[model samples]
Structures are given as C-alpha cells and as structure tokens.
Target: MLYNAVSTLGLSKRLQTANTELQLERLRNNDEIASGKHFDVAKALGARTGQAIALRNLYDETDQTLKSTALLQGRLGTMDSALTNILSAGQDVLAAASVGLGQPSPTGSSLQVRARAMLEQVVGMLNASSGNGYLFGGVEVKTAPMRAVQGDESGLPSPIQIVQDAIAAATGGTSSPQTPAETAAAVAALDDLFATPSASPLGFEGGFYQGAPSTAPRLSARLDRTTEIPYGIQGNDPAMRDLLQGLYMLASVDTSQLPLDAYKPYMEAAVAKVSGGIEGVRDATAQLGIHRAQLDDIAAMNTTQLRILNDQLDAMESVDPAEASLRMNQLEVQIEATAAATARIARMSLTNYL
Candidate 1:
C-alpha cells in the first residue's frame, strides 16, 4: 500500500475536485440557501420553467378572447334593446291608425303624424351600430344601414333614395314612376317598365308583382361572399307599398264623404304587415342573443381549460422544497467526510514517521 507523494497528491486533488462538483450539483438541485454560485440543477429547472411560461401565454390568450366575446355580447344586447323600442313605436302607430279608421268621422291627420314618427324610429333602429361596426348593415362597417332623404316629396329618407339610386345606377339611367298606378293597365305597364332594364336591373324580375326590383339594393359587405343583405325595404314589396299607399289614401279621404267604416279593412291589413315586420325584427334580435350566449359558454369553457393547463404547468415546473432540502443535507455530509479523509491522508508524510 506504499504510495508516492506525487501520486497521493494527484489522487487527493481529484477527490477534492469531485467532492466540490458533487456539492455544487446538490446546491443547484436543492431549494435551500446556496453556499456558493452553482447552476447544474437550475439549468434543468430552466427547461421546465420555459414550458410553464408558454402555458401562461396560452392562458393569457384565452382570457383575452373571453373578454372580447363579453364586450361583443354586450353591444349586441344594446342593439336588441334599440330594436324593442322601435317595435314599440311601430305598434303604437298601428294602434292609432286602427282607432282613426274606426272613428265615426275619421280625421287621420293625427294618425298620419304618428305614423311618420314611427317610421323615423324604425329608421333609427335600422341604423344601429356597435363597437366593431354597424349591426344591421350586415358587415358594412363604415356605411349607415339606413339613409334618410330630406326635402323629398316622397317623404322617404335618403337611405331609400340610395336604394333607388343603386337600382337606377345599375340600369344605366331610367327613373321609374314614383306615384302609384290606379288601373290594372297602369300597374301592368309599371311592371313592364321595371322589367325592361329601364327601371330595375337589380330588382325582382318575376312573380305576382314580378318585374319590380328590390327597393334596397344589395351592397358588397362581405369579402368572402358576394351575396348581400338589402338592409332597407322597397316601396314595391306589396306589403310595404300597400301600407304606404293606404296611408296616403287615408290622409286624402274626406271625413264628410267616405265613412270611416270603409277604410277599416285597409287599416287592418296595414296593421298586420307592420306587426309582422316587428316580429321579424324581434326574431333577429333573439337569434343574436342566442349566438352571444353560445359564445359566452365557449369563453367560460376556455377559461376552465386555461386554469387546468396552468395547474399542470405549475406541477411540472415547480420545485419540491422537502426533497431539495434532503438532498442538500446529504451533500453537506458527504463533503465534510471527504474533507476529513483528505486531511488525514495528506498528513501521513515520511517526515512524521521519522
């Protein structure tokens, strides 16, 4: 067991280096106070930390989406409220008109004023806008869904004019009659005029009232789809035309000549059509609400998923303090023992024996 001095020193140096390295590794792995600078365990933990950070990012994104959905839903709800108000106004007008027609000596001036007010309110509803854009404009974010025409004898707003303009524009340049025709021949001529590429190139070309094109011209609102939702009603839609014409006729009828009983049928029919329009608007509002609710549910589900993912990431990345403390203690003991052995071995010199 005789060992040369140089060989013993070399072995001692190697042992010291190995013990120091082991202690350093333990320090890195342990979640305790560090004795000196060390990074072996930290390097391994760093990889896990990176994964945790990525998971956090994902959670953030999901949370953001949830917030955005909530904001949009709120906007949609506001639009629905506006629609409800508009419907209420329309109902009021219909009720007043019906009563006016029922009066023994009908004076429809008051009813006509009320009807005008209701029409204005309907225009307001059609022009409702949200944060992202106009709600009724059907993806036309910049343009108002309904435009009002001022100072026109037609009593229609600019939005209606825009519709006519679009139709006229589409057909090169030919203006259709603004007044309703009295006789069947006149109506037939009007229909032919609408059909002959002279009045409406962009309207309905066939049916009972075929040849009359859509009043509201479809505009490109969606980039992916060419189909457009005409946001306004045309005067040609039998329901709308009849309603308007009936109102005008009522306004002109002399209370002294035509008995109120005679106009009752027209008033009733107009009321029904107005009611139908209100119902249609209500249905659309309900559909929007449902869509919003579904989005909310999806957002909630995403939030839950994000939470679970975060927990999993924490488990994968977080340190176990108890285990780290135990490893640290074990390494300390090994270092002390190695130091004692080295001191003893180094002291066993030939000079001591002599």
Candidate 2:
C-alpha cells in the first residue's frame, strides 16, 4: 500500500478559517436583525449604492425644510397674537377718543392718560419677540423695534414732546393751533413726522423705530423648492405709523388749551387716522392668514414627500426582521457545527486510525 501523508495541521487551519467565517456571518445577521438595515449596504446594493446615497441626502434636506417651515409657522403664530393685541389696544384708544369727544372731561385729562397707556401698550406689542427673534424688527431681529415713549424713566423724548414739537414747527411757536388752517397745518406736520419718510428727529424712524429701515425688504423665507414668502411685519409699517401718530396726537395735547373749533377738528383728525390704522392692521392680519394657510399646504406636501422617501429608502436599505432573524439562527447553527468540527479535526491523528 502506498503511504499518504495526513497533514492534520493543514486540515485544522482550513477548518479554523471556515469556523471564523461562519461566526462573522452570524454577527452580520444579528446586526441586520437589530438594526433592520443591511450590514453592508454598499456590498448589497452594488452599482445602485450611489442612488441610495443620493436618496438619503434628499431625505435629509426635505426633513430640514419641514423643520424650518414648522419654525416659521410658530413665528407667524406669535406675530398674529401680537397683532391681535395691537388691534384690541387700538380699539380701546379709539373708544376713548370717541367717548371723550362727545362728553369731554374738564381738561380731557383722562383721555390723554388713556392714550399714553395705549401708546405704551402698542409699543410693547411691536417690540414683542419670539424665542428666535423680534417679530417686528424685520431682518434686524436681534434688536427691539420700538422705543418706550411712556414714562420719564427713559431719557428719550415722550410722545407728548414729539407732538408738541410738531405743533410748534407747524404754527411757528403756538402752543396749540388757533385756526382751521393752523389745525390742518399742525395735523399735516404731525403726519409728516410720524408717517412720512423724512429727516426729522421726531419721526417714526428716528424717535420710535430702532429696527431695519422701512425701505428694506421685509424678512423672507423659503417655503418650498421654488416658493419664497416675505411674511415679516415691521414696526414702521404704514399701519403702525398711522396708529402711533394717532395715539401720540391724542396723548400729547390738552383739549383745554385749544379753542373749541380747533379741538373738534384735531380730535376728528386723530380719530380718522386711528380708524385707518385699524383697517390697515386688519388687512395685514388677513395677509398673514393667507401666508399661514400656504405654509399649511406646504407642510402637508412635505409630510407626504417624507413618507414616500422613507418607503423608497426602506426598499433600498432596510432588511426584513423575520428573514434576518431566521438567517441568524441558521448562521448560529452553522457556526456551532463548524466550531465542533474544527475541535474534533484539531485533535485528529493517524495513530488513532491505526
């Protein structure tokens, strides 16, 4: 009989290698079961791996956009609340003016007090902030939009002083208008200071607003792939100017100082301005509502897109839990069997057969 060499070392090394491979496969299957994704995505997807990567990137971008839209929605909601309060405050001032005209207090002192308080309240509203930034600051969100023009606490001039200056400028040193022409001129001066864009130190931009210039475009945000919306409301909005002008006019003067004829027209001018402001604010609120509705529609579309993208990613990268578990069990059995066979073969010797 021909003698054949039994290289047990070589056979044992091969069995050990096979056993290691089986153990590695078992670990991979276990990972797949736990994560519900492929252990080796590139190896599994091969040539389509680039597509998988692109899809994942797209999903992340969409998710970011949705989150941004949600944040903007929250900001819009905050703006709406501030605007609602402003409207209510304006109405309060309006009611006071209307009532005071019919039944005048001895000096219209009570109405002035009410107007001052209302002006402070409205300024507070304009200076309102969301957690992210100021609501009425336009793009200058880090700063308060309006200054406090209420008490002597602030070194800044009060609304009364501003109106007094406007009156003096218009009438050439009169404490109050003495005639209809003077009244019209005074009102016009007040409008110029409060509502017109001018270099006057008492104007809305100089005395009140400390935010982005009204000429600057309002803050805008990307709503979708192609749509951008400018939704920010500024403190220097025409509506805001009109309201502040009316409030300052009402707050600054004493009816007792004016002739009866001048007093009636002055109060009428102020009330008319307040009424215009109220209407303008309502329109602003309505415009914000429309933008909010558009955001809602965009949110819905994003949600649907997210679902579809998730499904596509799942088809490309996700593993069936049941199938992965079954494979893991098979791999476990195979690894155990390989370990046992390697152990037995490692101990093999030709002397035992002999």
Clashes of each: 8, 0
lDDT of 1: 0.51
Q: lDDT tens digits, residues 72-118, model 2? A: 99999999998999999999989878875743357487778888888
What local distance difference test score does each model get? 0.51, 0.85
C-alpha root-mean-square deviation, each candidate: 10.3, 2.6
Model 2 stretches with alpha carbons more than 4 Å out: 1-6, 100-107, 151-160, 171-175, 178-181, 349-354
TM-score for each model: 0.51, 0.90
Candidate 1 backbone overlaps, count: 8
Q: Residues 119-233, candidate 1, lDDT per residue (tens digit)? A: 6665566566667566554334565544432323334333333333443333344332222221222234333333423454332222112212454353222211232222322
Can you tell me which runs of candidate 1 are displaced by over 4 Å? Answer: 1-61, 101-107, 149-269, 318-354
- Candidate 2 lDDT trough over 10 residues, lowest sum: 100-109
